[model samples]
Structures are given as C-alpha cells and as structure tokens.
Target: MSYKLIPPGKRRNRHYWLRGTIAGERVEVSTGCETRQAAQAWAADYVARLEGQRVPGIGEVVAFERAAELYKAAHPHLSKSDIRLVGAVAKYFRNKGKACHEVVHADLVAAADELKPGRAASTKNRKVIGPAAAVLHYAANNQWCTYQRIEKFWVSRKSNREPARDEDLAVLIANVEAPPRRKKFGRKADYNVAFKRLLLLMLYELGLRIGHLLTVRWDDVDLRAARLKVRIPKSDEIASLELSPVIVSELANLTSATGVNRPALGRGVDRRGRLFPWTTNRGVHAWLKPLTDRLGIKYTPHMSRHKLATDAQVLPDKKAAELGVWKDPRSLHRYQHVRPEAIPGRSAATLLALPAPDKRKAS
Candidate 1:
C-alpha cells in the first residue's frame, strides 16, 4: 500500500490516503487526520485488508515459463545462445514461482539457495540469473508481473575471484601441446593444433570475439608491418594489433596449406576467418577445457583478454594507461610501475604491439 500525505488545512485538519489492492480487491483508506496518525492508521488497515488470506495475490503469480515466452516474443531476433538462455531462465523462474506468498526477504533468500546448487558459477550465474532478472525487470515494467525484479532476488551474491596466473597459463599451454586428444595412432595427439586453437589465439592476440573473427578477410593482414585489423564487435572500436613475424608466418602457412579456402577469405575479401574452414566457439571451448584441466589451469576465453590487459600494463614501453582501460585517464597512475609478466617463451611474444586499427580507409 502507498500513501498520500496532505498538509494541515486552515482548520488544522489534514488528509492521509492509502492506495493499492488486497487479493485483487482494490481498497482505499483515508484518515482525515495528521500525517503521523494517518500513516499508523493505514498500516493497521492494511493488515485488516489481508486478515484471512495466506497470500493476497497467490493465484495471480506469473510463472517464469510464461514470462520467458513473453520475453522471447518481445525479442525474436536475439542471438541463438541468448534466446536459448532466455528459455533457460524462464524455466528456472517457473520452478521458483511455486511460492504461495508475495516476494519477501525469505523468498529472495530461498531463490538464492536454489541457484547455489549449480557447481559452475558462470553457468548458474551471470549467464543465467542475470539475464533472468533482466526479463523479470522487463515484465515488471510492462505490468505483466508483480514482483519488483532485484539483482539479489534471482541470483546469489558473487565474490571477487582473481584471474589465472601466468605460471598456470604456461602449464595449460604445455599440456595442450604435449597431450593427446583423439588418437590417430596409438598415442594421443595434442588437442589445440586444430583450427579452434588458432581462433582462440586470435582472440588472445587481437581481442577479437567469434562474431568479429567470422568477418575477417585475408587482405586485412599486413604481414610486412606485422599488424592486423580487427573490427571489434558491438563497438566502433576498430583495433589495430601489432603481432610478431612468427605469428604472421603461422597464419600465412595455414592459409597456404588449407585444402580449400572459404569465399569469405578469398581474394578481394575484407575480413579474417577461422584458420580451419569450418568451426564453432563450442568446439574451441570443448577442446580447450580438457587441455586446461590436464594442466590444472582454470582458463577460459576471457583469460586471453585478461592476459593482454595485464601484460600491456606491465610493458616497459607502454604507457600504463594504454594497457586496456581506454575510457579513463586516471587508471594510468595505478599501473604506473607494474609490467605484465613475460609470456611463455613463444616466438609470437617477440611481435610488436599494434595500435587500434584504422577503419576509415574502408569507407
């Protein structure tokens, strides 16, 4: 219930009014008295409004499943994963919507409890509850749902976990290089030599997302300059990354050796592509996870971005501010003396760092 406080009248009388309904029974309470007395009286009347019911709007609850359907209908063109995730969240909320009471502190806590059973934090969290809360917020906005969407209502509290150490990165790299994935002969072959690893490396080396990588063309590479152009996803930022001769050589060799080239990578094309003709992000993650496990590394696609930011900040030649925090000038001071840990002694480490790519030339 909400109240309207009125000032004292000429005769010193004031009006206090309450609004909102109980069990779909719209109720209004008014006290031609002072604000304090009216507030107190309204609280008493609110309890009176719900005297006999366990929940005022128990049957009016909108299931998460239903909410998800509405959300999908609202955004039919979302990415495949995003659409799938919306469905997942809807199912999750549908299960949680079984409660008999309006959302309370306990209901929120209970919701958190249910979400905590999942072992993968990212899977059960940011990707799941975060998006689910977004849908609920949308529902609440449209008046299709009652509960006020809250961050804590749909997910558990998150803690700050530090990223992987370089030593761990080294171990993971080593493991992938030496271990066997599927055996061609009696011995297992190293997993990442396939196209997925190259794709991953592009993300690491150029900070390119999979969508952005799919748009890459061969002519964008300036092998002699040891630089490449990557038009970033979702932003106007076209990054010009400097690379090493060895890195360039690796890509050059792959292009030359592939049995057939994709039309996207053909002459006169304007984007880079998966070094392997056909692949997906799922395949890359599938291959990378085992390698990471064997090496006891907790690496993910994001680690490459972290490695770049962390390493760039530590570079003796790089202005600490230029490390990765592009928007704020104040952060340069924080990393003033810090330098990125040296990468594993790979030939690519010797490459030059490239500036953000110039995209104006394309237009």
Candidate 2:
C-alpha cells in the first residue's frame, strides 16, 4: 500500500492522519479513528474506494465532512447562498462526528431544529434540510452512503402580499411622468423619473422578475420589431417576448432625445451597458418606496409581476406560463390572485339573481 497512516502525535492531533497518493490523486485527510489498527483498515478501504475496487456493502466508513468536501468538489458552480447552506450542514455534522451513511431522517430533523431553532419551516428547509440532503445524495451516488430521502416541512399556501391594482398602477405611472419639482438636479431628476416610469411599464407588460429586468442590456431590445430578449436567470435560458406598443414608444423617445435635449448626459441606450442605471434591486426599491408612500398605495417592485400574473389568468395555462417565463404551467396558479368579480360564474349579480325560496314556509 502506497498510503501512509501516521499515528496521533503533536502534528497529527488526536485522530489518525492518512497522507499519500492514490491513482495520481493526492490524499490528505483524517481517518477519524484513534487506534493504529483501525486507522490502517480505514486507509486501505479509502484507497480501495478511490480506485473503484471496493463493493458498496463493504465496511467503508465516510465522514459527513469528507462527503461534503467531495460534493463541493463535484459541484463547483454553487451559488453563494447554496454554498453557505452546505457549509452550515457540514459544520453541524462534523461537530457531531456523524458518518455520511449513518445519517437518518431523525438526524436531519434534529440538525434543522438545532441549527435554525425558531426559524420558519421554509427557512429550515432551505438552510438545513435541502443542503444536507444534497450532500448525502451525492455521497450515496459515489457509494459512500445509502440513499435516504429527506422530506421538507410543509409550508402554508397563503400569501400576504396583494397584487398591484390597475388603478394604483395608472396613478403611479401618471405621477412618475409628471414634471419633477426639483430643478437643481434638472436633467438628472428627469432621467430618474423617466427610468422609473419605463421600469414599471416593463415589469407589468413583460412579467419579468426584478433581477432579470436589472440585467437587461440595450442589445437585448428591438424597438422596431417591438420585441425583447430576456435572459431567465434561474433556468439560464433566453426568452423572447413581444413588447407592448407603450414600451416601444417609451424606449424610442428616450433613445431619440440627445445632447441638450436629453434627460441625462450619458447615452440613453448603450448597446453594451444595461438598460436601467441602477445595478441593484435595493436602489430601485429605495427610489420607488417614497413615490408609493406619497401615492398612499402599498406597492413593491415585485407587485408589478404579481399584477401581470393576475391579469394573465384570463389566458390559457400554457400561454400564461409562457408570458411569465415559468418552467411549469402549474406555477401560474401560485402567482394568480383572481379578484372577486373576475371569478368565472361566481359574480355577486349571479348569486343575487338566484331565487330565494322557503322563507315564507319557514316563518
């Protein structure tokens, strides 16, 4: 065996350390065993596992920490939030001295309870359960553990956020288009106003998420054809949408105005640069809040998207899903908030028209 098993000492800490090369891959990790005999056995098993010589049912023990490391190595493109979640799960399991194969449903539930405590079920599912399941599943795929399904906590279906009303949106658009009182900033203020107005229009018309809208460049737009090419961030797919005439007109007006006649100094529609001046959603929301507050309407940037989804309920499921860039047509159900009057065959007039019977007999 080319693998070297070093005994516990000043350098090796309490656990036995395995360091050497196997199959041209450098191996350096703790065996998580105290006795020299156990360490030697672990080192041989690990080398055999690495070389694909060992069967799945063999006495091959893999620590949760090691399994997590392997999972991370396999998937290098995980998002920052996903990385944090995986790290948190690995840390908890490492502290517990848990093996990847030994983890059960109870262990996962306990981990969630201990790690997230009083957090919501959805939060725990995202932060703990989901990440831990991913690591364990990856380990199972590699024969380091048996596959175990981890179920997520059931979350409520009720949503607190109401979709923006047509009247409210109209009021917002009118207010943004009206002249800015602050003449000191002059063109800068006008530019900001114009940008907000256009942003609202696109959010309502295109049914795009706020993140997708912020990243759209001028090259993605075709005002002449009244078309827009939006990059869906989640799926990493480009979706082409037919632009509304209102949006095309606004974009044309902004692009045509230049020099002293322009709203701002910089190019209105740079082919390379993003369409909106703001890089982050926080900046857009901060600018929008005061306007919403002044208008006496409770609104958010995402509310525009909800409004689009609600309005699209009249269309077929497939058509509605396409409008929202949803991968599943069923997802439209979650977003659509049908008004009382809009519910098919359930209008107040229809109920009123029904004959009221048996009232005299009861009296």
Candidate 3:
C-alpha cells in the first residue's frame, strides 16, 4: 500500500502515473496504461521486484524475450556460438509473446524442431533447447519464474569415426614435407612446406582444439623453457603445459625461419600475432580435407584432440583433464574412445585364453 496510481490530469499525459516509495527509494513513472486499475497492478509488480518479493503471477507477466536478454547480459563470457544461439532463440519466442514461466518441455522441443529442421538431434540440442533452458533457468534464479526442466533429444552413437592414428598423421606430415614434383618452384617452397609441417605437428602433439590452437599468440610460447600456455576457449582458463623435445625443436626452427625474433622478457611487444595463418576452424578443416582425401584417411583436427584424450587416459583423471584443459574431469568421457584391444589385461585374446569354470564346483 506504499504505492498509488495517479489519474491523468492537466499536467500529466493521458497514461496513468505511479508515484510512491519502492524499496526505500522514491519513484515516479508512467505506468504505460490509461486505466487506474491497470496502472495499480503495474506499480504493485514494480514495487515487489525492488523489495525482493516474488511478483504475483510473474511468469504470466514477463516475456521469454526479456528473460533471454537478462540472461545474455548476466553471462557475458558465453562463446560466440552460444550467444548466437541465444539470440536466435530469443527472436523465435519474441513474436509468440511466450511468457518465461509458461515455457514447458514441449515448447522447447517444438522450437528446436522449427529452428533446426532436419538437423541432427545434437544440433537441435546445442542450438535451440540448450539456450532456451538457460534463459528460463536464469529467470528462475531471479524469482521471475519457476525453473524449467528440458529433456534433450537423444543422439545416436553409431558413428564409425575413430581417433586419428599416429601413423596416419605421420604420413600426412611426410606428404607436406616432400618436395614438389615440378621444378617450377624454387627454395621458397621449402619454407612454406616447413610452416605447414609445423602446423600439423602442433595440432596433433598439443591436442588442442582447432579454435584454441589458431588463437595461440607468439607470446604464449617459451622456446627456451620448452613450455607454453594456452587459454582454453570453452572455459576461459589458462593451462601451462610442458612441450616435448620434438615440438620444441620444430618451434625453434619455425621461429628462425620466420625471421621474427622473440622479444626480450619484460619488453612491450605486440602479443596479438597468431602462430597459425588460419583464423577460423572451418579454414583449417578446408585446408586439411584435400590432403586427407588423397591419403584415404578420414582424419580431422578434432580427431587429434580425441587422440590426445584417449592416450592420456593412462594417467589419473585429474592429470588427464589438466593436459586437455577440461574444466571438469567427467568431460574426458566424451573425448575418450579407447579401442577394446588397447585396454590392458582385457584384450579379446586374454579373455578367450582363460580356462572354463567346472559345472561340478557350482553344484
């Protein structure tokens, strides 16, 4: 009862005005309604919000679009892909005038279907359902609505894709290092080939996501210490890692070849110079595709990351997670696709070699 609505008068516009104290602050604003009753309701909700009280029927009053906007503003660290998905979801719900609390499981499922038609379930989950749920959960946290539990579409695991093999990568590297058959190209070609070889080596050896690898700057590496730091794109974390002797040698050679001397410690130099020429993940994939096709292998840059995770499974989960820059150790399950034969003491031959148990013992 601390708030009151004032009817339109000579000094005020046609819309009703609200004047009162809310949360110990004096407030005066147009209610955007001509009737006193409507203005009174608006003032009540506004006061409730400022007083930290749950607004009555808030789910029906607040739109999903508004909730999504607040969610985006609250999470500025969201990746570009996630931001785009949230924007798309907001646009879809904007025209519908869908209320944040009114959003249900079916609505998100339908949105996914419409927004990503004919796309894989994983695509729909990542691009539509995930963002929609995020908006709703954020709204719920602020007492704007109840939390929504959305069930994601089931994705099939029948893909034949396996992690990249060392031998296959070696073959690809050799192909890049080999001199061109035509003599039209001079010694300059050697330098270009050397650059490509280093790129391939780092992609597999470091086991970094293609996006993370491309963003690596010259300042992030230390040739003298055989160490480097990579900022994980997904979690926005810095991971300091030790480099192998082979990688260290390749990096030194590439640095000498580029003729760009590393700046002295404590010197102010431009740290924005990227190590690789490719900027986008698509660019790296497009460049590697033809080379992979010629070698009759289905290897991709992501497969190299999987290979690293799988090989690193030999270490403790915490250590493995550190090597891959995964914030959660459980995330290792998604990247690891260990071959059955590669498991110690659990090979097919070892299982078959075991003597059969006697039926008399059981009786």
Best by lDDT: 2
Candidate 3: regions farther than 4 A off: 1-60, 157-159, 178-190, 255-272, 339-363
Better of 1 and 2 by lDDT: 2
In the range 1-363, model 2's lDDT, one tens digit per residue, is 367888889987899999888755787999999999998898888887886532234346878877787777778878788888898899999999999988998999999999999999999998899999999888888788778778888986555668876566666766664335555655433546667778887886665789899988878877767778888856668999877656766677664223222222235434457878788999887767777776677888788667666666356777667767877676666643732111121111221233442211111
Clashing pairs in 3: none
Assess every candidate by TM-score: 0.46, 0.72, 0.72
Candidate 2 — what's its lDDT? 0.72
Clashing pairs in 2: none
Winner of 1 and 3 under lDDT: 3
Comparison by TM-score, 1 against 2, better one: 2
Ranking by TM-score: 3, 2, 1
> What lDDT is reached at residue 218 by model 2?
76
Those runs of model 1 whose alpha carbons end farther than 4 Å from true positions after fitting are 1-65, 92-112, 115-123, 144-149, 153-204, 207-250, 256-273, 281-302, 312-363
Clashes of 1: 13
**Candidate 3 Cα deviation (angstroms), residue 167:** 1.4
In angstroms, how far off is 90's CA in candidate 3? 1.4
Residue lDDT tens for model 3, 251-272: 6655323454334243423434
Candidate that beats the other on lDDT, 2 or 3, i.e. the better one: 2
